[model samples]
Target: MTTHSPHPVRPGHGLTVADAMDPCDYQIADDSTVDQADNILRSAHIDYLVVRDHNGRCEGLVTRTGLHPFLTGSWYTERTAVSTTTHQRGPFAWPSMGLSLAAIAMRVKRLAVWPVVDDDGYLLGVLTASRAAGVLDAVTTP
Candidate 1:
């Protein structure tokens, strides 16, 4: 039997990408020099940074490995790290996914981190496995 509840499901309300993501200021502009980007990454103490363009659009990702080649290259000091990102990103965490079993899916994947993007592919934020677990716990706890 279908029982009526006071709060019905909304289209897109809770646990959205915006809610689950660990908001960070670790985005590096695409035009920034490799040195500049490296500094940011170092200061943030993170292995990955969301790569954004002039319009603040998600271009790709910049990881420690992605920057490895440049570290040994002669032009490393002069080149931009944007082009070194992993173009074919593994998975993107969309805000809409949080509506369903997306968080569970990510947890199952065991990804260290992933990017959260909007419909327009803008840089929303980053998501970590621990953060996803926290969301799952919160949703299941009560």
Candidate 2:
């Protein structure tokens, strides 16, 4: 009698998504409007804001690209502060995700920035696609 042995599964290796993602990332409150997010983006020199809840958990993300349209036409007024319109939904990735996966998501989604979350879905940090690409280029070129 011949018995077949079970195949052993290989564990995941390499840099997890958290490794590629920034941990001490900036975040904005959900109560903040589009206008506020825009000003913060410009001053902070960032394209995306991780929207946080009252408890400081990440809820969503707002991008300057999404806020730009609302500034045009009558939608915006002179008295309107950078806190009027609501921000767009946020995109997030898990820490266990691979760098390659993150890179693919950034390219296919055309995302300028992506937020990294913990196992509990708590906000971790922001990952700029440009920065990631630059780092990758440096590593691969050398």
Candidate 3:
């Protein structure tokens, strides 16, 4: 996953998280039912969903693994909140963060999806590993 920038794109050369992040359509209300969250996850074909609070602020993230318990047997009939499935509260990135730095942070955090948020903790989008790799490819390729 090593990428050598083609030009002189230094650490703070202006390439940022916003440049590589995609619109976060995979978001669910914190109070949403597990079934509803599961439906969105299935429809979006994403690994996880960002759980937002009433103010549309990022509360945490819910992965499919977290919802597994509720998806099977009698639990499926019960009302489970998406927030209950969320474990990671943050390590969120700012839009102005340098892309390469953000990529490194993502690696260190072992995160496949990095939520990009504003100062107020509102989720702007997600910077997926694939997307970051794509940007690196574009920058490093001849």
Clash total of candidate 3: 0
RMSD to the true structure for each prediction, in A, is: 4.7, 5.6, 6.0
Best candidate, TM-score: 3
| Model 1 TM-score on a 0 to 1 scale | 0.69
Worst 10 residues of 2 by lDDT: 80-89
Q: What are the per-residue Cα lDDT tens digits for candidate 1 across 78-117?
A: 6655655444364577766763366566667655677788
Better of 1 and 3 by TM-score: 3
Candidate 2 lDDT over residue span 1-102, tens digit each: 997759653333355666567765567776666566777789989767777876777776767766777777575654543334455445578777776678
lDDT of 3 by residue, 1-142 (tens): 9998788754435689999999977788888889998898888788888889999999878888878877875745658777766456786999999888898888888888888999999999889878887897687777
Worst window of 10 by summed lDDT in candidate 1? 81-90
Candidate 1: where are CA atoms >4 Å away? 1-16, 73-77, 87-91, 104-110
The CA lDDT of each predicted structure is: 0.69, 0.68, 0.83
* Quality of model 3 by C-alpha lDDT: 0.83
TM-score of each: 0.69, 0.68, 0.81
lDDT of 1 at 105: 66
Which lDDT value does model 3 have at 22? Answer: 92
The residue pairs in collision within model 2 are: 35-82, 36-82, 36-83, 61-90
**Candidate 1 accuracy as lDDT:** 0.69
